[model samples]
Target: MVQRLPLDAFFQRETTHPHKRYMVQPQVGGQIEELSWAQVGNQARRAAAWLRAQELEPGSRIAIISKNCAHWIIADLAIWMAGHVSVPLYPNLTAESVRQILEHSESVLAFIGKLDDWPAMSGGVPEGVPTVGLPLRPAGRFDSLWSDLQAFEPISDNPQPAADQLATIIYTSGTTGMPKGVMHTFANFGYTGSQAVELFDVGADDRVLSYLPLCHVAERMFVQMVSIYAGQSIFFAESLDTFVHDIRRARPTVFFGVPRIWGKFQMGVFSKMPPKKLDRLLKIPFLGRVMARKVLAGLGLDAVRYAMSGGAPVPDALVDWYQRLGLEILEVYGMTENCGYSHVGRPGSRKSGWIGQSNPGVDVRISEQGEVQVRSGSVTQGYYKQPQLTAETITEDGFLCTGDKGEQDGDGYLRLTGRIKEIFKTSKGKYVAPAPIENRLAAHSEIEQVCVVGDGLPQPIALCVLSEAGRKELRESLQGSLVELLERINDSLDKHERLRALIVIDDVWAVENGFLTPTLKIKRAVIEGVYGPRFHEWMEYGTLVHWHDEI
Candidate 1:
């Protein structure tokens, strides 16, 4: 089990299995287009030649803005091959934000591909920056189309980046203020990538589905770096409409999802098989196994050898529900600074809300202030151009301060209490950690998204958006079942942490609306800004499941 670096994997695969299918991309309709390892490598080589032909200085920064696509990855490979740094912007970012990131990153060239918001993106490019569009056409004029570079021969001696050289400058999707770029070197990726393959026993036989925003470290690690490291074939989902079909076609051996996506899968399952029927069926011993298998197969998760959820807390109840179906959703904890490799629950472990033990070669410690800190080979060098902030984040002892408050059990499993900034004191003078309570409330089949806020109030109250099933269930009982659900949740919490009422918000929280980050973590400050003033009013209503219209 030799651990190969990402670039080594690419060249090795290219020479070993030139014609082997490496990537399968969904086209318009049900069709899929496959690319061999050689073809992918060749395209990357040609693109690299084109990039170098521009004569930008070595280590110049380049930008990539696109949805998940094969071409997006090709451009990334090309960027590295050309000895340049890649700056990936979320496809859904506002034009103003895009401009700000590009300007701040000092990117000399940008590649645009597979975008839904072309006009906004096209307008966002800095006026003098050179732009090249991928297969997808840009809204404005570009210096070159991605296809034009295919005819060029690759550079005879493409520089292989050194381990210490900067590989990328990834900008965090800031919930509080301006996003800061996190600088990572090739050594960081090499360390984390090899560690993941070794820890998970990932091999070439494993298959993966790439659907999340690859700009994020999690998706980049599992979908790109891990795939490259293990020589595994990859699949890209076309759009949200075709996600299920794509998953079925890919039949990924390993799947990673945020809590929101997992909740939706639950909702989808319950839609066809009503909860009453599902509960009754599960009561039977042998039939329960058969039914669970069928349900998992129907959802395209039956083939999943490993399933993971991260970026937020997943409720224990939700994990238990999946375990009953014979699929254990392991909880993972990491950040962009750590290359998305930190703590991970072992497969078939107990259903604890804890995120699990530290990875091999990663050290985790709780600071005296109760913040989670780490010292690892995979940790980033520092934030780009933010030395003061970087000094604040990395302690004098050489550990990266995670800014998350957590406690480690005797067994070394870490249970996160809350973010330092997010802990709020109620009027009763008791501090409440909102994440645990909010995670518990979100476990209800009806609630899709939730945020808990009670600053200066008697008790914390929840603002939740209903899932489709939640909406359907709400239509039937009005508020009875929801009230019952809240009672159960409240019973499990400490007196001060109990949610007083669950207010139903009609609107969906999305990245476009600034309620969610691109990676699906809630923008708490943004959520609080819009809903904070009304919190006292909802708390005073003195009822459960307060409907927006009824208020």
Candidate 2:
């Protein structure tokens, strides 16, 4: 069965259910604002009219700089309606990073909205590119305003972009070097959006929170494309302070989060009820369900039927913890190249390591050298303007060189071992995969983030960051728990893979600090570069566990 294009499906919603509430936005001063399908269409058409009046060449690249909000989606639709391509930027990027992307994509115009730090980010807009200030933006930022654009008459005719035409160029939040523009066609989103609607069983009644960066592929596909296909209502989060209230008010049925987000949710529960006490109570048959529901309801996740974790590998123990509460966190494995339509865990997939089965159209295989490769309609055309690099990435047979090594079971379940580039040889002539080891170490409630590196060393040592639980505990107590965690993990591994020391650092590995990507994955190369010189000093220390601050 051939599905209609994404815009056509959305137009159906705009014409048929014009009055249906499609976007629920939270405003300042504790007020709520809503835009029905008709309202959304009106604004998008008005913006489209304004864009068309500019007389720019067809398929011009327009950029959007904003946090997740209703206007972000409206601006995207307007870009499409005006027969142009959209380039979405991560809202929290630095000025230099922002300018690099805008100048690289050569965006003709930019729409700004919903930011915490416009003053710092404003200089990134190149001098020649025109800017439109979207609603909910910092005041006096743009030469033109989105609200004023509505004065123009709405476009009378509906415009449909061709199936294979370029729709969006999503930039990669790179773990190394400059970000690459991943060009995707409308057909890419349409196929994934249609498949996602079927996979999630979403409909108009389904509610979702739009809190993750809208520029991200996972959020773009789940929140934006899925909503367009299923006609789901999207709720926007106002800020960090009101997140709990916003989710409670929305009561989303379909929830998606990265591993860090899932960890934060777990920490919220632990903040109220200690994990030890909660674990004991969960074993009590009659009271377990009651406590689970109570905890979930407090976090506004009681109504969540489908909870997805993606972008980074979720720790197996974290998944089990939620499983004990009768909530299964389905781990999804995908990349920006595939538009996030790769593989997913179903309801009954309560396994420890596997990332579940492949999606219907995606063919997953372990290459001869052990890299995980994928081929599907959802894959990107190639990296924009870098044909040589694109040739190096995509195989002759069309599979994307995922750069990940993995093993597959008989039933097609896949377990990622590590990145091919991440597996490093030690001085003792042993190769170690840090991802699995790090996943095991992160199970401890005290260790929020862990990275294992031992290149050209006798044995790999773990660099750790304290979780909230770890931070509140006495320093001596924190040391003992991590020691026990270290010994437990080492007992299950080869002697060569055993960690030499656990070094807890005082610094935060944040995006602002250049240690983490926007999606919260640690940049191993950067981390190693900063700490590699200190490894010998750390390994020769007296104790098995060392706090860097103490030294």
Candidate 3:
């Protein structure tokens, strides 16, 4: 049996292991920076000492606001080392939302990184709390993290936190209200890390590109934890714009991405060589191998040994398209409450349209209502402060009410249908899960963002926002091509689930517009309200076919 270990032990273990590379960061405009296990551990120790000097009580909540960086990991380890809980905030969160999270968590201190407007965003820091800014620029004000580390002695003694003690509190946006803090423990993270190492064959030889927000549980668990446990080197991408450049520079052995990023990669490849050219190349056996290598290398995916996609449902077509290029895009299923992964598609065990089998030590079952329920050591104990919500979500029996509707096959592969709350009922009383249908429509290389809505209506409809490349693709296609694409989508759906109409919009749905969460998850209710009336007008006037349909 695996014993429960404290979070800091992972780092200490790596420090003692000779030849272990702890971290690597691909600088935006400079050379690749590497850190050994000893170096990272020493930095984390100094950070812990600094936290101790602040005089905060053990288990005090501390917040981190920044993009993915080396300092972010150092700060996180320090927080755990000092027997405190870490709260990571998304870089793009609004001032109001940031204030709410800090206030809700009762955070005592905050560590900030480079920002566009520091003073304005710093206003979110509660009164009487100290704010330390991370100076990306050498001359910036406030005590620099590197400078502080140089001044303080490294804290060596490890204070072991109980297995049940809270480790981290990750906030996730809810459908109807403010985000809730999902409280996890040392056991939750440690066990999940071990399980991932075993399942993915993660080892010191693996290299990971850490670009996604550490605030998100998916990245925190997979990229961060897997690296620490397996002694893999993690290279941070400077930003989204430099993602491709960084990926090529790192040549990572493991890659994890959201569906949107994966879809963009596919679009990037198709843009260089159109489908006709690709189809023709496939017919030539020797030429196909030559062409595939050239294309994969050009896209910076040539060295990626394993690619996984999560955070949202991925379209089957997108997975197949990548698989054709010798890239097996494994679809993983889990959430913030489950420490990011409960099920993952394994090599030689991948099945289309399924999220794969449950990870070891995880128990997953489909309820009579089709809601997916999971019981695992990695599962959160409860919500931070909402007892009622916790009770409703996690039962006394220890199963977590996943809130996602799904089904299990005889072989134990799980296929997600939709969210229990997001499913809509038609006027004919037929319940429709928009996720599968929406994923199918969005699978077309052109679509970017899509929302499916038809509650209390005769049939469901889809509101789509085409990508820049998508709009260009539509423009180049013949009028008959557009009709054929729509017909093809319709054929994939059942009669009741077929989209009544499609409305393509030029505007993007984003957090700034109140149409998306900070994590880029669509706020479906908000979008429905904004576009509901317009959709009705188009349907009544038969103006839906117009490219510039007001609705």
Choose 2 or 3, whichever is better by lDDT.
Answer: 2
How would you encode candidate 3's per-residue C-alpha lDDT over 454-489 as one tens digit per residue?
A: 887777877787766677754536335545666787
Quote each prediction's TM-score: 0.97, 0.98, 0.94
Q: Estimate, for each residue in 1-551, the C-alpha lDDT of model 1 and write its tens digit.
A: 33455676678778888998889987655677999988999899999999878899999999999999998899999999988999998989988889989999999999988888788667778888988888754466778898788879976664667888999999998897789999998888888888998899888888999999999999999889988888789999989988898899888899999988998998899999887799789779999999999889988999899999999998877888888898999899999999988899998665477888889988889988899999887889999999999999987867888889999998888999999989999999999988888877887788889999999999999988899877766354757778888899889888898888888998789888999999888898888899888888888896777886678
- Tens-place lDDT per residue, model 2, 107-167, is 9999999888888888898998999999888776577898789999999888988999999
Enumerate clash totals for all models, in the order shown.
0, 0, 0
lDDT: which is higher, 1 or 2? 2
Candidate 1 has its poorest 10 consecutive residues by lDDT at: 1-10
Q: Which runs of model 2 end up more than 4 angstroms from their true locations? A: none
The candidate, 1 or 3, that scores higher on lDDT is 1
Model 3 global lDDT (CA atoms, 0 to 1): 0.80
**Candidate 2: clashing pairs of residues:** none
- lDDT score for residue 404 of model 1: 95
lDDT of 3 at 353: 84
| Global Cα RMSD, each model | 1.7, 1.2, 2.2
